[model samples]
Target: MNDNSEIQDVELAVSRWLRIGVIISAAVIVIGLILLFIHGGSGYPDDYYPHSLSEIYSGTITLKPYAVITTGLILLILTPVLRVAISIWVFVREGDKLYVIITSIVLAILIISFILGKA
Candidate 1:
């Protein structure tokens, strides 16, 4: 195959992935809204601290169903959006793919940490 064909295939693949990501993102946003409504809204007061790290590590933290679900939904929506932006920036400038990959990984880890911490 010619270089042009290869490039076209890559572009098509990327487009397909982007479309899937968008659909998933929309679904996550809907779920997040549903959770926000079910959980009594997004803005929690300072006194609403639900868990201590020690208790969480000890597996004693009382996990609130709504909070965990809402947090996961929010992360699901945000992570892909962030990844796409970073990926586009990197791809456009022909920057290092490693940077994009590392950024995505770090964001994922942070999201997981936040979810676990809140739970």
Candidate 2:
């Protein structure tokens, strides 16, 4: 395949990957909602929900519905991060220095935002 074709293939793959990630995340959330409906999630108005990774993971490992929902939401949140990482890989492989640098910066900013968002 020519360079253009190869690039197209990569782009297509990236798009499909993102689509699949979103679909899977959505499905997970739907399942979690179903579980919540069946098992009944526990939370009073005064209680704050679990939003931290550790809390979510601990609950999820125990099959807690709300935590499962949080896991799905986290997966949805990670889709773009995965996309950016893939774009960086593609750019590097293509020797597109400008794009590689720009994508790298975007990735860095994304990481920083996640870190700061948690604080």
Candidate 3:
């Protein structure tokens, strides 16, 4: 009904969305970790290309599980990084110090996870 109330509503909505994002990101990282473990922790296999560029040229590319898992892990890492970057952009545009702080923390956590995943 009032300006302050509208701002509170918007803030509440943003907070809820951020919480959901964090949960989803955590889930993705967990899933990626599981896949990495299940697939022997190797990033990718070179054998998926059928041993030559000519094979790919011939439209014969075998999809290796290792390669797929590695790609999935990379995607999982990149998704949260992109989300944090977007959040940072929005915070900057809106001049919201709290959101900037929160997003920065999230970004740091994602970076840590990526590093650990690599290890």
Winning candidate number (lDDT): 2
Return whichever of 2 and 3 wins on lDDT. Answer: 2
For each candidate in turn, the TM-score is 0.39, 0.91, 0.42
Task: Tell me the deviation in Å of residue 54 in model 2.
Answer: 0.8
> For residues 13-50, could you state the per-residue lDDT of candidate 2 as single tens digits?
99999999999999988978888898866421346678
In model 2, which runs have C-alpha deviations exceeding 4 angstroms? 43-48
Give one digit per residue, the lDDT tens place, for model 3 in 14-69. 66666666666566556556665766643445434232334322331233334443
Q: Name the lDDT value of residue 103 in candidate 2.
A: 97
For model 2, what is the alpha-carbon lDDT of residue 7?
Answer: 85
Clash list (residue pairs), candidate 3: none
TM-score of 1: 0.39
Which residue pairs in model 1 clash with each other?
none
Cα error of candidate 3 at position 116, Å:
2.4
Task: Summarize candidate 1's per-residue lDDT along 1-119 as a digit string, tens digits.
Answer: 68578557666766666667667656655665665677664434544633544432232123333344444455556655565564556454556677767766776786787688766
Off-target runs (Cα >4 Å) in candidate 1 are: 43-119
Cα lDDT, all candidates: 0.56, 0.88, 0.58
What is candidate 2's CA lDDT for residue 92? 90
